[model samples]
Target: MKSGEACLHRLVDKWLAPATVLSVRVVRSGRMPAQRARFVYIEAIAPSGSRGMFFFRHQDGCWRVFPPHDARPSLCVDALAA
Candidate 1:
């Protein structure tokens, strides 16, 4: 499994421990056309018979609970040589 996927699993295990994961789906967000999957949706059932959905986003080469911020254009200054 990829590092990002592994991170997602770890997150699920940490936050949703003792819960049974029902399904996991990966889909790309239209906002970030350059990258692969921008988000992952997971469906799980807890020991208490409660169902919940989780969303994970790909950011900084790993999976995170929050979405990545949009990249903005920036200007860079270069030094001049004689």
Candidate 2:
């Protein structure tokens, strides 16, 4: 299995233990313009008939849970240069 899939399985296991995973699907995938990072939105269903969604982001060459923070424009001032 791919590393990302394995990581996802681990995450699901950690969060939803005792609940059998029925299905997993990638709802969306794309690069975040701000961070220029790849991300995947997933939807999972458990045998207990509960559904959950999560966002997995690719960062530092690893798949991690939660999307990266949005980048906001900020002003930078150089007092020495002024």
Highest-lDDT candidate? 2
Clashing pairs in 2: none
Query: How much is 19 displaced in model 2, in angstroms?
Result: 3.6
* Backbone clashes under 3 angstroms, per model: 0, 0
Give all TM-scores, in the order shown.
Answer: 0.54, 0.53
The Cα error of candidate 1 at residue 24, in Å, is 8.0
TM-score of decoy 1: 0.54
Model 1 RMSD in angstroms: 5.1
Candidate 2 residue 77 Cα shift, in angstroms, is 16
Q: Write the per-residue lDDT of candidate 1 for residues 1-82, one digit (tens) a residue.
A: 5654647677766665553644434333233455444665554554555444445455545766666666678755553332
**Per-residue lDDT of candidate 2, residues 1-82 (tens digit):** 4655637666756664444677776778788787888877666677667555565556555566677666687777785568
lDDT of each: 0.54, 0.66
Q: What is the lDDT of residue 63 in candidate 1?
A: 65
Q: For candidate 2, what's the RMSD?
A: 5.2
